[model samples]
Target chain A: QGGVAIAECAACHGEDGIGKDVEIPNLAGQHEVYLYRQLQHFKSGKRSHKEMRFESRQLSDADMQALAHYYSQLPR
Target chain B: QGGVAIAECAACHGEDGIGKDVEIPNLAGQHEVYLYRQLQHFKSGKRSHKEMRFESRQLSDADMQALAHYYSQLPR
Candidate 1:
């Protein structure tokens, strides 16, 4: 919905946020605050994971906000 | 492989350890230590999430260890 294309995320989190089984997590239906919080955490290393941290690093605050909004709108 | 039925996990993490989508993280192909650490985190409140903490609370040390071992063995 924002500048970042959904395609990049879809590779892991699914074209929808219903990601691949187990290794990935479903982003759909999550609370926007929680999603934004985690993305911030991933970016800041408050939450530690190589891939997520790297992915989050690429996102701007606006991107995180928008993506969180995008995914939160999805059905679980 | 362990006494705990995979069915308990399959509800969310799949019959294997691959989680449903973005909200749930994949357990497959993850390191055993990482899995163990997260389970411990969830149980101990180092990580916070109602469902995960509740689920982890139901697991014993042995169960967490075994499940980590179990899920870690699955191919990504």
Candidate 2:
């Protein structure tokens, strides 16, 4: 499920959870809850990253949680 | 300089760069540029978190960069 959810994320945040660019954040080993909350914030407009907001809007609560867990487990 | 800048941060983001609470983000091994950009966003009100905004207001550009480097170097 996480692998499927993160298909789009791999473009900017690589398969290893390392970001493709300096401006992008590395998700590897980040706090799971924090990642989930940031996704929620993006969906609600509390966090203002245009692409993230659009991407997060496509996720369900379960999808977000799974994606956060998947990334948090990756080596930093 | 990074050590000095991270004094207050150690309270919430621990000395090891792991967050003390679930709501806080772990900074260990995060991309330096991304961390620096987030700090700038907090200071400029582009990102909204009450405590972070207040804390970031106290930093200069050099301080932010040093703090970013400091946390990014910690083991995740």
Candidate 3:
């Protein structure tokens, strides 16, 4: 499930979960709960990132959870 | 200047920039631009965290930059 969503994320976040740009956060080795919360914040407009908001809007709670887990386990 | 503001952050983030809780982020070695942007988001209410919003509101742009630089240099 996360692998599917990660396809989109790879554009900026990279396949290794390391962000392609300095302004983008590196998701590798991040706390799962923290990542999930940020995704929730983006979805709810509580964290404002134009692209992140749009991307997170496409995810369900489970998708977000899976994505967070997937990325959190990646090597930093 | 950043050292002064960091005293408050040390309570939760620790002197090493490691978060005390899973919900909080580990700031050590994070991208400076990313950290700065997050602080700006908190100050502007673009990223909504009750405590963070209040803390960031007290910081000037230069203060945020200093704090970002200070934390980003810490060992991960």
Q: Top TM-score: which candidate number?
A: 2
lDDT of 1 by residue, B11-45 (tens): 88886665676566556655577678888988988
Number of the predicted model whose DockQ against the real structure is largest: 2
The global C-alpha lDDT for each of the candidates, from Candidate 1 onward, is 0.75, 0.90, 0.88
Residue B12 accuracy (lDDT) in model 3: 86
**Candidate 2 local lDDT, A1-76, one digit each (tens):** 7567698998899889888998888888788999999999999999999999999999999999999999889987
* Shift in Å, residue B3, candidate 2: 3.9
Clashing pairs in 2: none
**A3-57 per-residue lDDT for model 1 (tens digits):** 5545677778875676665656666655677678888988888777788888888
Worst 10 residues of 1 chain B by lDDT: B22-31
Q: After superposition, how far is residue B76 of candidate 2 from its true place, in Å?
A: 2.9
Q: Which candidate's lDDT is highest?
A: 2
TM-score winner, 2 or 3: 2
DockQ of each: 0.10, 0.83, 0.72
Q: Candidate 2, residues B1-76: lDDT per residue as tens digits?
A: 7566688999999988889998898888888899999999999999999999999999999999999999888876
Better of 1 and 2 by lDDT: 2
The list of candidate 1 runs beyond 4 A from truth reads: B1-38, B43-76
Model with the higher lDDT, candidate 2 or 3: 2
